[model samples]
Target chain A: MAKYLSKLSKSTRSNLYTVTAILAAYIIFTVLIATGNMSNLLQGLLIQIFYYAILAISLNLTVGILGELSLGHAGFMCIGAFTSAFFSKCTVDIITITWIRFTIALIIGAISAAIFGAFIGFVVLRLRGDYLAIVTLAFGEIIKNVINVLYIGIDQSGFKFSVKDSVSLNLGEGGQAIMNGPQGIFGTPNDTNLTICVFLLILFYIIISNLVNSRSGRAIMAIRDNRIAAESIGINITKFKLLAFTISAAMAGVAGTLFSHNITILDSKKFGYNQSIMILVFVVLGGIGNIRGSIIAAAILTLLPEYLRFLENYRMLIYAVVLIIIMIINWNPTCIAWRKKYSIRNLLSAINKKKEA
Target chain B: MSFISYLIKGISLGSVYAIIALGYTMVYGIAKMLNFAHGDVIMVGGYILFTVMTSLGQSPILAVLASIVFCTLLGITIERIAYKPLRKASSLAVLITAIGVSYLLQNLALIIYGTETKFVTSVIPIPTIKLAGGNLAIPGQTLVTIPVCIVIMVSLTVFIRKSKTGRGMIAVSEDKGAAVLMGVNINKTIAITFAIGSALAAVASVLMFSSYPSLTPTSGAMPGIKAFVAAVFGGIGSIPGAMIGGILLGIIEILGRAYISSQLADAIVFLILILVLLIKPAGILGRKMNEKV
Candidate 1:
């Protein structure tokens, strides 16, 4: 451990510290679950933490890295959840293997979300700041409302989609309904588990981290820092913005698939603007532009409600207070310089000096 | 409902939206920040009126006056507490703080009023007006709403155009530093803008919940968003544009609800916003300005 720590750059070493701490915690929790020591409620929280982490990381790309604010992250997640859940429901009898079915579902989810991301991002990304924020928010609300009235079913003939009512999906005796228009697509098979969730999180972390560290990532950040400067240097503004938004959407879609498989039933109401706001809060609290911060924020906030069960009704109120405090702490200039004084780097350097003495 | 009746309903709803959207546009025009908690002021207005009318047994006129005064104060307080510190902060930070204030208000209402819907009796006591040779009917509330909206919009425009205080607001919104150099009381102008905008919100909520009396903590949320959409649909910083946008949004929303899927009303509103923003990024009436390099 000492040898591994000795030769690395300070930033890399600190990042390693964050990664190791999260990993160690996860490992310990997994053991507790395996031994049946953890509560059922906490076990459920594990799946949520993974998916929320995926969402926060994806949002960080557009919000933190790309410097675009989106109030419609849940819109992409909705498309993902409904599409993948619907796909899984229809193919239940035909596809026996859960793993294979989930793989196909994830791919479909990613593609569909990317398609939507491209369509919306292409239009809205042309503008910047408040306009982009509002349009994305509108998109999210539109998707949620549309999903409320959407109906789909499957039968011997093939797949069918309807909007008016469920009865319109006339089918054979063995026909099955996936989404009954506002009733939501129910009867989804529970294929999500700790292993799959952890795998997805790890994959998301690596992809997002690598992207943030890449040349394109630098270009993206450059555009965010100064649009005209980035443009003067001949950076293709639209291309990179589109790339980041599409990738972010695709990742959210993957998270949505995992989310659907984890939950017993899927509903449009679950993916409202409020849900999007909550995810944004996670990104903000996690430390904008910090992937490790996103992971930790998602985990803690997702589990906060369950842990604060005794506080019950006051939990969200308290959560609001915490959110304000965190935002103030993060942005307040005096607090920032103060943070540097107590920051881990300072603490580490102090410890090293003591060791040398 | 006949096309005309639907149109009326749409107009009335549009009027409510216009009043609310005007508040949004004024604040945006002056402060250069989306006052997310602006909608909550409407909710606060409704509850205040509800308490006055129901609890204190005050007359409708008294209740409304009280509501306007209380909300105006509330708006000024909110700006001073939540937004003042965020003046030099990034727009995103201000935006987030605005949202946090929104959540704080909603949850506080949840705690105080509880989760159940609190019904408020209609403020407009007039009977329904029937047209189409006595075949079509309009709610009494609708009749009151349309005129009130028109009055508010015209007066607001005149206020912004003719009044020195209003001109100060425009100057501040244009460039705060320049306004300061020009001897504009930047803080006072911004505070007055908040006060006037919030006063309008109180008026809007009272009228909005008159017909739709199923009030809850979340009642302001949807209207708040739709009004924001209206503000954007017109032009973020333009008053007349907001009025036109609010009315058009009402018509579009009502028509969609009646002719298309009723459940897709919200979606239709948002879709229009997206389409408008894509085609005319500056909005229908918004002035286009070049971003500084």
Candidate 2:
């Protein structure tokens, strides 16, 4: 078995490994779903894992690769969710006529978010490091507050208009009311299926992985390593940064669409400052610049609390402790250096030297 | 109350922001880090005071002092554990670390305090004082906040300008390498800066809680970001500039809410930031530093 594994080409081996992993995951999910005893709690947890994984990977494009700290990625997500929600609301037969309207909503959401990302990038991309982070943070907060106040629902008396209108839409009786003020938009269509979400996620993962391995990704890495040397080599920092930001925003929009449709409830609070920080946490905890690490981290973080259900009220505390431990381990240079110093190659060479002696 | 009364209110609120902004500016000036966790530290201080005030049943002044001490220790510890190690790393790394620490702190608070809003009773008696024009009422809390802010600001200015340690801080902010060559203790100075800055944030927290009296885990997020904006608006490294910028921002926000649509108030502040950046990227009081090629 070992000889056969070693004989396989690197790409073939990796592809086989990925296929096996996916099959295993699918089998496990199917078993869990089929089991009558498992609660909706597990199902909800799995969905959240998939959702946050998309968000973390999207954010990692800018933060981990481009080496820019953006506090406004959530704003892009907000734009995407709201855009898709708006369209889904307008069309009644959303689930059946999915192909055309879904594509349009997704495109529109991506384009709008990308446009906003580009505009913000042009303005604040000049500032690097901490300055850029603060500006972006403020930008995110401003976007959230603006969305909060902008009335986007149909009113009663058959009047559908914005908050600027004189007559307000009275979402009568039931919770099926129009986007309530500050309460957030409700009754969005839950058209997101697991298959579609998984397919898109895998597609994004491949694209991002490829991009990070390409020449442009190398240029971004170079800039991240040493700005002066990269600039001296004639790399256009601003252009590349803007590209990363726009792409990241586009991906975030996709995630937003998935999120809005999956939950069927959209609120301003869902895309607030905390959500932005949460994405950042996932990226960092998963090992920055490591896409697989981010994916694994997102899945684990989303599922860990669910698994530790007995902790109950102390769940967050346990999560915090685990995070602190992980951070300490990651940040400790001595441990990393030691591992590098005493690798299998070193052990093999040392054994050979002793045998020769 | 007259417009002047409104002006006073603005100034008072701005004074609090200025105090908070000073912490941001000074730390950034020296470390060149955004300290995303700084505002959360302020929130932690407020929570500390709330705990002390509620548990010990102590007087307001004593509770405030205890909270400052608690926050000062927290600030120093955070610097040592999270930031000090990343000092040599890229500025972005430090910022990420700051964010992580912030999340850690906020979640810790959430775990400890739960997500409920804690109400704080006023420490100082509410005093209604008449002013010129129609009758302007001033809360005793506001009076205390203003004087305390002035005293701290004045003392900070003096410390930075006059004392040797303060001069060492200035030198370090100006040039870390050169300061080290000149026999400055870089770590000590940095730690001192964090202590002072955290203490100022503690003061801001106490004042804010005194006036508003409600505290929650996420409370620090907005004020922290706004204070950072104030720091930027007034030229990040300049103290007096932060003071002016904070007051100006406060007035703009309040007046914008009163006159214009309440919905557009936040937008207006952001527009101001954009306009300021376009017009004067260095900020109102900030001197443009030439980038080294």
Candidate 3:
């Protein structure tokens, strides 16, 4: 009985939920691919599943765990996408080794996004609550517009930069244009696959869940749970906030690299206020502090729009209805009381007892 | 001359923005929530007005009244259904609920209005006012938007000053518990605040879409955000401050387009927000409050 109890408790550990969910998802995906059950549409959506999952997890760190709201995640993602897209585009011919270049792209993307994150975090992390949301949102918008008007090119003379028009890059005789203002980077690389995505997803899961259970993560949560109490205990609010924010930003950037490499042509419009808000929605709906909840929420919501495609224009209306209903069910007082009364733990224990009898 | 005309247009645009800002500022003042859906409510107004005017060929006044009524009802309904339950919930919870409401509204508009942009017919027939020997000309829409904004602002200020419900609202914002103990119906006051704010959004939406000559599902989003910035700029809860902030923001945005690269206007507006946040988090006209704990 004690052995059974210990095993039950090990499997039921809450942080391990992400592990369980990912494994289940991976198995389902593999089976679908093996049996050829996944349609092309769903296959395409798999990329979104991986990237959005990455985005939601990273956003959850700041919004759910760090007790801060950041609306600029898409901005970091944008920086990552552009950095890697340009890197890949410029080096596609220069670097003969495809795997090496992809690895370099990931490193460069992560570092670039982290640098931007550190810059933005330093400016905005001093503020508390809603102010952070607003600043991050503004940063996301600024980055989108900046990217639209920027131009980059590479040739024998190395990289050249201009704005407003790509023609102005004025690369040498054999220069190749990497980015055209507004048009974004066209004809980059499409290297994203379920295998890479799953591997990266696992890596992301390990990093985030570990951080959540770490000493630094505890201190960060202390600040969130009670700023004054945490301060009394001698936690440096600024350092931790910056650390969580920059790391979250770096992870989002890695997702961006994955996303950009997946798509043949990258458009700046995809990484905008709407995307940021959508990611935030995923975090919020995922029960804030629940890592597994974020993963599940991102997966479900990413597939929802496509699932409702049969409804066509009305799908969005249905989407809104679903949002309101979910909040009502999850946040309603009566529902909360009912859930507590019929708690999962009690139900599980009852089943165990019945089995023993 | 074109520059001067842009300035005038900017002011008119700012006037419309002011009316919208009034909605956000008042709601924040009383409800103590950012009311993220206030912008989406403006879209609702535009769609309603667009449908009524285009479908029924109703008189402009009728269209306007319909919009106002629809938004008022919407504001109340949103408060009762989504927000009332979460009144005691955490700030993040309330914020999420507010966003859900926003998504609900935008998606609803998308369903009903379709993905296409609907051209909004002008309600006001005033001719373009030419000045500077015809080098500068202001559209007739400006005439209606600016004057209407002034009239609304003045009336709102007066109503808040003398009216009983207005006083009740003031008391509630000042201190919710005290207001309730003093015989103010907290729910009613909150409802009325929402009604008035949403009514104001109706006017702003009509002006916004009509000026741009088109109404899309996302017609109100940018303007809505800009107006919120205006509300914040003016010291979120201050009526007069919202006015100043809206007008200044409109001018800066327009001039930014005229002089600086048009693409960077949003960046500039956001930069100003950050600078203001860094320098004065409470905003220019906002009274600073010490943190309680």
Candidate 3 local Cα displacement, residue B132, angstroms:
2.7
User: lDDT at B40 for candidate 2?
Assistant: 93
Please report, as a value between 0 and 1, the fraction of native contacts recovered by candidate 1: 0.58
Q: Write the per-residue lDDT of candidate 2 for residues A37-128, one digit (tens) a residue.
A: 55888776666777678889888998899888877778899888887777777664545687666767777777878888888888988876
- The docking category that best describes candidate 2 is acceptable
Tens digits of lDDT, candidate 1, B1-293: 49989899999999999999999999999989888888899999989988899988999999989999999999999898777766777777777788888888888888888899888878889899887688789999998899899888888888888999988988898889999999999889989999999999999988988988888888898888889999988889999999999999999999999998789888888888888988989788988888897
| TM-score (C-alpha) between model 3 and the true structure | 0.94
User: How close to the true structure is residue A85 of candidate 2, measured as C-alpha lDDT?
Assistant: 78
- Say which prediction, candidate 1 or candidate 3, comes out ahead on lDDT: 1
Per-residue error (Å), model 1, residue B113: 1.6
True contacts kept of each: 0.58, 0.22, 0.45
Question: Could you tell me which residue pairs clash in candidate 2?
Answer: A155-A169, A156-A169, A156-A170
Show model 1 residue runs off by greater than 4 Å: A1-16, A334-357
Count clashes in each candidate, considering only residues at least 3 apart in sequence or on different chains: 0, 3, 0
Please report the candidate that would top lDDT against the real structure. Answer: 1
TM-scores for chain B, listed for all candidates: 0.97, 0.95, 0.97
